[model samples]
Target chain A: EAGVAQSPRYKIIEKRQSVAFWCNPISGHATLYWYQQILGQGPKLLIQFQNNGVVDDSQLPKDRFSAERLKGVDSTLKIQPAKLEDSAVYLCASSSNTQGANVLTFGAGSRLTVL
Target chain B: QKEVEQDPGPLSVPEGAIVSLNCTYSNSAFQYFMWYRQYSRKGPELLMYTYSSGNKEDGRFTAQVDKSSKYISLFIRDSQPSDSATYLCASTLYSGAGSYQLTFGKGTKLSVIP
Candidate 1:
């Protein structure tokens, strides 16, 4: 089966600029998530979507970060007025269902560098 | 304390040695435990998973979960250079929603010297 797919393997932008990352989850996956992984840290959940509706976004920095998963198959994460501290890897993951362990399959991730 | 705590180790070991990695969690509600292996510039891949407490072995990898102690462990037997990578431990707790929340550790880096 095809794994999750992410676009723009790497990105570099100046602080205060805006950037967006795209992701395509595996077919038939009903749950999708976006996470941010900083250097020397674990991936932290930014948002989660069940189909086209949002399941959680409590940790998301709404003032600067926004995400959408329209139609439930593809997702986009945007960071406006990016800060130097916002540099990190953006990861996308998906699961077929929410039962039991709900093992997530992840994409290669989009690396961002804010200068 | 963090929900999950792990030693961020660049542990180096000779080939054919036994490697043990562990993580501790403060949340007793966590019932699902998983271990993931990640290579440089690649996303994490699930290596092992166990439900509740007990041990599950696959190939040369063994996963142990002790809910009473709020600890989980992964053991690799006869470790090889190919096994060098970052290992992440994750735990999840069931919620009122159909899904659960997964919390991950900082990950332990392992290097098997040839």
Candidate 2:
């Protein structure tokens, strides 16, 4: 089984610019998550989707960040007018409840650098 | 206090030594405990998972949880250079309606010199 796939492994943009990251979750996985990991900090959940509908996004900054999972398969997270604090790795993870627990498998992540 | 607390150590040790990493969580509702290892520039991978307070061992790694103390630990025995990475401790509630939000520690960086 293929693991979660993410694209644009690295991106560099000036502050106030826009950037977007994509994620393709593992097949048959019903839950997808977007997390932001700043240097020296742990990954913080940005959004979570269960089969295309968002389950949780209280941590997401609505003014500058937006995400979508269409057709319950692929997801995209976009940061508009990015700030310096947005320079971090965008991690995508997927999980299933087959084991009666939430065991997530992560993608390599897209590193963003806001100059 | 943060949900999970860990010592962010750039800890260094010689190979074949034993390593101990720990975390303290504030949420008593977290029923699942996990340890994840992340290599530089790579995403984290699950190293251990356990429910209830006890110990679970796999090969060179062991995970222990004490719900009463709200403390969790991951011990690496005969540590190898390849084991050098950032270790993150996480806790979450059991699966319910497919909603599982994991709270993670800041992570402890470990370096094992060959």
Candidate 3:
């Protein structure tokens, strides 16, 4: 099976600029997640979508970070006015089921660097 | 205290050696324990998953969880250079809305020398 897919393998921008990353989950998967991983740190959940509706976004920096999974298939994460601290790898993951452990399949992340 | 705590070790070991990675969590609600392996510049892949406290083994890897102590571990036997990567420990529980919240520990970087 094809794994989750992400676009713009790498990006660089100055602080206060904006950037967006795209993700395509595995076929038939119903759940999608966006996670941010800083250098040397574990990935942190930025948002989660069950189909097209949001399941969680408590960790997202609403003022600067936004994500949407439209039509319940592909997702886009945007960072406006990016800060130096916002530089990190954006990972996309998907799961077929929500029951039990719900093992996730992840994509090679989109790396972002904010100067 | 952090929800999950792990020592970020750039641990190095030679081939055919035994490697052990561990983590601790403070959340008792976490019912699922998992281990994920992440190569550089890539996303994490599931290495092991265990629900109940005990031991589960798969090929050259063993996963151990102790619910009472809120501890989890992964052991690699006959380690090879291919086993070198960052190991992340994660814990999760049902969080309503048909979703679960997974919390991860700081990954331990392992290097296996052949």
Best by DockQ: 3
List runs of model 3 lying over 4 Å from the truth: none
Write down the worst ten-residue block by lDDT for model 3 chain A: A96-105
Interface RMSD over true interface Cα atoms for each candidate: 1.2, 1.6, 0.9
Q: Model 1, A8-66: lDDT tens per residue?
A: 99999999999999999999998888989998788888998888888889999999999
How many steric clashes between backbone atoms does each model show?
0, 0, 0
Model 2 stretches with alpha carbons more than 4 Å out: B94-96
Worst 10 residues of 1 chain B by lDDT: B92-101
How much DockQ does model 3 earn? Answer: 0.80
**lDDT digits (tens) for residues A35-62 of candidate 2:** 9999998999999899899988999999
CA error at residue A102 for candidate 1, angstroms: 0.6
In candidate 2 the C-alpha lDDT for residue B6 amounts to 96
- Each prediction's RMSD over C-alphas, in Å, is 1.0, 1.0, 0.9
Superposed Cα deviation of residue A6, candidate 3 (Å): 0.1
